[model samples]
Each structure stands twice: as structure tokens, then as C-alpha cells.
Target: MKKQALSLLLALSLMSVPALAKENSADNFVRGKTYAGQFSDLPEGHTFYENVAALYEYGLSVGQADGTYGLTAPMTVGQAVIFAGRIRSLYRTGDPEAGPAAFTAAAIGLKDAQRVYAPYLWYLQAEGVLDKALDEQLANVATRAQMAHVLANLLPETVLPPVNDSLITQAYASRRRITDVTEYTPYYNDILKLYRCGISVGSDETGSFLPDSPITRGAAAAMLTRMVDPSLRLTPDWHLPELYSAEGAAYEDLVTAGTYIAAPETAADYDQAVRYMLSQGENTLSLKYDQDFTVSSAQEALNNALLAVKRHCEQGYNNASCSYNAAGTMILKFSSIAGDRTEEYRSETLSAAIAVHDALWQQGTITPASTQREIAWAYYQWIAANCTYDDAGDNTSVSHLPYSLFHNGKAVCDGYTGAYNLLLKLEGIDCYALPNATHIWTVATLDGETVHIDATWGDQGNTGTKQYFAMTPEQSYSLHPWPKENELPQ
Candidate 1:
């Protein structure tokens, strides 16, 4: 047999601890020897094969007499204590068989069948690894939480260093780390200690550690191997999906545009109701009114809401219709431009929008101190330079929303106007979408003056010229007609 080199700490501790246990002990313990036998069940490609092999290689486990590893068998509390004792003994003395002889089965008051675990339990208790209060539960099956408690302190922090502690702390602060494990949970700190040490990554993407669930032998083997081998540790992939922050100026824009509704009384209320429906990635909304409304008024409100949805909301809907009943419930339906939106699809779209917004902000060199006019010009130039006029005469759904301008790099009049309006609102600048019979553009309050900007025309031949930037009403009307009612001062 080849002699394996031990750490200096273990070599030093060997002089203080007692001699190895009897050679005929039930554990059949061996030191400085690697296991050569293979389990019939743990073949190559098995998920637990590598960890179980590591377990055998370190003399932590020898499987069953039947020559098969009971991978799915529930790990008992006694077995957990035994594994913890073995790990501690190996780390402290370089041999799993050595422990203090002052502790024994009779000394711990173990009477009958539980006496089999007495040596390991007494060793752990003597070494401060096992609390005396946990002695009664040694006969039952161990839960994941119990397993964490048993294994958490088996090795010191020097050996089991916390690698993912910061990430875990952040996720826990956000309440996104583990859904089931809370501060009130038993042994919660112990479980988190294991997680920080990379011994266990929760069972799911959400980091859901079903603490009360029984742990199987295969799972135990995986955690046990990671306890000693830092290379086998896993980093958790538990990041939450990003969504538009309610604290951002964009959310205030949504609120101001009447996208969030509590009641449907005023025009803004109805508009916000429709906007809310569209933002939810849904095509239908049933708005219940608190006050009585005439059929024409309800129809007019629906039209206004639809217009607001088209202008303010980034989602694209091709067509819409509404029906009002005597009961004051208006059922509004819309045909989405992007068909069949799932939660995942919505998350992906929002993520893309955020990415585009961040990239544009960085590349445009727009700062908080930048004048509204300068910011507006930056947006105008970036859009004109990057996006092309969608020459396709057919009204595609994307062409009606900013998604076309930012994602596809091409859009018609409304897409350009919508993108501009949204970007201005996100910067806390006041802006509006101005639409004529066949054209749409932007009117913004810049430098205490109202200015007309047409990015679509500015990007003629994909050239971002300043042909229509900072134009007064008089200057813009010659090229694009402005409605008298929606007119603004120069």
C-alpha cells in the first residue's frame, strides 16, 4: 500500500488523539488505503458514480455486503453521524479509525439496536461535533436540514472556506435564495453554512431547499464528497429574472401615461386599464366601472385607451374592439402583434428591452446633468444612425412599437416616434407622440421651448442628418402637417 501525505495540521493533531479502533470493528475501517472494489450498481455515466467513487477512495463508505450501493435509500440519522465522525477523524488524525476511547455506547446511554451507532455518535459528541440533545433522533431517518446540521461543522472554515457567501447573502436579502428555508427554520444557519461552503446547491433553479424532505444516500454521497474536496463544490445558479424596476423613471412614465388603474372612471383610468392589460402580455381586459357611463362615452374611452396603449405601451397590438353592457362592464379585446406570449417570453422581451436601454444610454454618452435638448438630440442621432425605415408597406405589428426600432433595427413612423417618446419619458423628460393622417413624429419640451423632431425623415437613406431636429411648428408643418388642436409654441 502507498503512503499518502497528510496536511501539517492533521500530522500535528495525530500526536494528541488516541490510537486507531480495533481491527475487527463493525465499520471495517482502514487508513492510508484506497478502495479497489467497485459497486455493481454504480456504473459509468451514473450521476452519483463520481462522488460515490470519491467516497470509497477516501474510505468514507464501502457500500453494502450485497455489492450494491443503495443510491435511493433514505439516509438514517445514525448513518449521518457516522459519516460526520469519519470526516472529522480523517481530517484531524489522517485516519478514520482513530478517536478518543473515553466515549462509548454505554456512556451515552444507548440501549438496544441503536448501540450499533454508539461508537461514531460517542466520538462526535466527545469532539463537539454532535450535540447531546440530538442523541434521541439517531434511530430515525435524517432530513436534509438534519443532514446539513450534522455535516456543517465536521470540517473547520480553513478547510471548508466560504466561496459563494456574498452571492448567497445578496440572494437571501432579496428573498430569492431559498423559497423554503427561512430564518425561522430549524438549523437554518447550518444549512446556509453548507451552501456558502458550496457543499449543497438547492434542489431547483429557485434555490428551493425542501428542508424537511428525506435525503437519499446518493445525495448524501454528493454532499459528503464536496465537504472534503473543494473542486467538487458547485456554484448556485439562482439569479432571479430581471423585471422593470418600479422605482425607475420608466415606471413613473407608465403611471403618468395611465398604465396602472385602480378604477375606470376618467379617460386616464380607462386608458391605464387598457395599458395595464397590454403590459401583462394579454389581449383581453374586462373593466368594471363604478359610475354609470353612456354607450358612446364608454366606446370613446376604449378608443382613447387603445390609443394610449399604442403610443405609451411597448407591446404591439394590431387591432382592438370593445363592448359595453348595461351592468357597466366593458369587455375590451385586442389582437396582439406578437402572438402567444408566455411568462418566459415576456421575461425575455423585458430583458432585451433593458439591455437595449442600457446599451443606448452608455453609447450615447447621455448623463443626468445633460440638458433635455442635448439628451433628445443624442436619442435622435442614435436612432437615426442605427435604425432604417421599414420600407415594407404592410403594417407589421412590430413596426407599430419600439420593439422594431430597438430589436430589429427597422421601423416605420410610429415605431420611431414610439421609441423616441419612451426613451424621453425614461429620462424624466416631457415628450409626446404626434400623429397626423399618415405620419407620426415627436414633440418635446426642450430648453423651455417646444420642438418637433422627425427621426424617420432624418434617417433618409439611413443617414442621421439634422434636417428635422429642433424645428418649430411653422418649420415642421411644411414637411409634415400638424393638427391645430395639438399645436404647441415654438
Candidate 2:
């Protein structure tokens, strides 16, 4: 079947040679004249019109003889190699037509069926721009991945510098860059190099490269133009809809609040302000008091504000410090539990965590008839079954926050306690996170009795156990030491 298709493709290529030659003849090859507008199919409003115009103006492409650009036509590997070879030649020499004076398929040891593209194949292979493995697939329609391999090394980094390298690196680290491309994909590094050079963004908003899909003429034109003209390359501003919509009624109100606080007088006001900032994924905030205060009074206010933040905000704020500026305004700087993550990354992580929380809530079998103890046990089991302990011991990880447990499925005692407390609060059960010198656990009021639930310890290998659920203070303290008296609620 493949042989039949290749034979048909070769016959078609042979039949189209006369038309292609006429289109590329000296009579039609006018320097600096845009041939893209001449094509009846490619209008100014077309998405690839500018790129095709650039391709034509640079003599890299000439449209079909039928006055159409064949925008959606699948580009063959032969055409791709020819385009790549032309681009290399044009970049090296002032003229696009500059290449080996004479070459043939027989001369390069290629099959006679590839005679139409033999010169281009020989030129590209001699220049080290084309891989010899592609010789067998010259008649096949080039996939996007194959096109990337063909065009990647046409120009050196001097002309095609990787402008979006850091953004691509970050996107890959988060596993959100290209949906279809992975480390195991063929020519994976070449595909990424195209993105870093801004030669291609992707076929969709999610940055899906569609590696198996055939490349279209318009898409090929866009990529070819970008290779020669750096200005035409794209800088990906990844629009992650899933992350944005993951907030899902969990923190919508808090995330939508204003960041500025006009007059924060009481501890409650300060607490609300801090919550607003954290919800908006801010790491720094300036709180100006309506009245003046001495250094000692400001220090007290800062201490109170920190306490309020710790009590009301639990979005993985590890620590915070405040300083009084010359104008007596208090500037607070917070260190996030998701260390070194950008504000956008932190916001997305929080949204993803909220999505997990909402999903678990919807999946739970909780009802009005369910007892408080049963509800607590259900949450404890769910946390234990779903999340594993973070044994990596990375201090900068988000293991200290609920996000690690909800999104990453691995966290420390602090993450387990935070997540458990969050779910219990959603069930209208009063719960608080109790922290000791080294570990943290949840203290919840179940059936009019206060009991400790340590999900971290409850998670024993494959599934969660009730060994630490609904334990008395004596039982819990036997395995895990009790928190300081000052840290415990009266």
C-alpha cells in the first residue's frame, strides 16, 4: 500500500514539474514584487497572507500555475526539503537561486523516481541541513514533526537565536508546552528548537503541535518565512484555559477582590487585606495606615498582621516580614510555599488545587444524614488514599501546602493537615490545623467531641487506614507529640 502511494505521488510530481518550472521561470521571477496578492485564493484577510507574501518576495515559494496558493494542500517531504535548501542558500548568499551548478538523483545515489527533487536533496544533504533517513519518505506528505526536523538547522543561532527558550523551558517543566510533543517524540529537540526560535507556535491555543498531522502549504509558508525573517516568529503567550477555569467556585470571591486597602485599622481588616493579596497571587503588598505610629507600635501592628495572615490565609505562605518605609507605610514581603514559582504559576497551581477540591467534594457521598464522625473519617480516608508522603525532602517544594496534596498527590504533614482541614470546614465541621515542632495534623470537633486526625500517618502504603483517625489527645500524643500549649486552642 505504501509503495502504491509513493508511486502515485512520484507520478503526480513528474506531471507538475512543467507547471512548477513555468511558475519559477525568469519571466515570473521579479525581485521584491509580492506574488501573494496575485493569488485569487490568498487575500489580505487570509491568516497566512503576510507570510506567503514574504515567502514569495524572498523567492522561497511560487504559487501553483492555476492562480491559487493551495493553502490547505498537504506539503510533501520533497517540497519541504526544497524549501529548506532554498532558505539555506538564500541565507548564505545574496541570491536565492545560488546553489550547486548541476546535480541529479543518479549522481547522489537516490532513486530515479526522486529526480524532480534530486538537486535540492543533494544540496541539503551536502550542506548537512537534511538527514539521509528522510530520503525514503520524500514522496510522502510531511508531518509537522518531519518539517521541524527539516527546517531546524537551516540557519545557525546567529541568525535564528532562541528568543523564547526560557518560556518554552518553563512550559515544559510544568508539562504544558506542547500537547503532542514529548521527550520521546522523534526529532523532539528539533521541534523544541523551532519553538525556542519562534518559528512555530502551535496549531491550537493549548500549544498542541499535532505532530502526526500533515503540514499545510500555508503552515509551511509561515514557518519558512519565520526562518528567514526573525520578526515574523511568534513568542508564545500560552493561554491555559484549564488552569484559569480551575478556580471553580472554591476561591472565586476571594480571587476577584481588589488588592488595594484604603484604610486597614483593625486586625480583621488587616486579615482580609492579606487574604485578598494571597488570593490574587501577590507576593508583596503595601498597607498604609490612616494615622501615624512609632516604630514600637508599628512593630506590634506588623506582628498582629502576621498572626492574622497565619490564621485567615492558608495559601501556602511560608513566612512574611514587614518594614516601615520613610512615609511610615508598612511594606510586607511574603515567601510562598511554592518556592521560586512566578505569580502566574502560583495562581495556576492554586486554581488547580481548587479544581481538585471541588472535584472531590462533588464525588463524595456526603449527605445531610451523614454523621460528623463519618464525614471526618471519609475525608481522612480520601486524603490518605489519594496523597502520598513527599519523601524528596525538598524544602522549597509546595509540600507544605494543600496544593501539593490536591494537585501533585504528594505532600508532607503540613499539606495533609491543611487539605483535611479545608475539606472538613466545607462540610460545616469546625476544624483547625495543629502544628508541633516537626509535624502538623487536623483537630476537628466530631459528635460534640474534639479528636485528632493525622492523615499523613494514616496513609500507610497503598491505601489509607483509620489508625490515627478520631484519636483522643492521649492516643494521638502517644504517636505524635502534642503541639505547644500556646499554639493549641483553649
- TM per candidate comes to 0.48, 0.47
**Candidate 2 to truth, TM:** 0.47
On the 0 to 100 scale, the lDDT of residue 170 in model 2 is 48
Residue pairs clashing, model 1:
258-272
Which candidate achieves the best TM-score against the true structure?
1
Clashes of each: 1, 0
Clashing pairs in 2: none
In terms of lDDT, model 2 sits at 0.68
Give the Å error, residue 121, model 1: 4.2
The digit string of per-residue lDDT tens for model 2 on 431-466 reads 666656677777778989999888888898766787
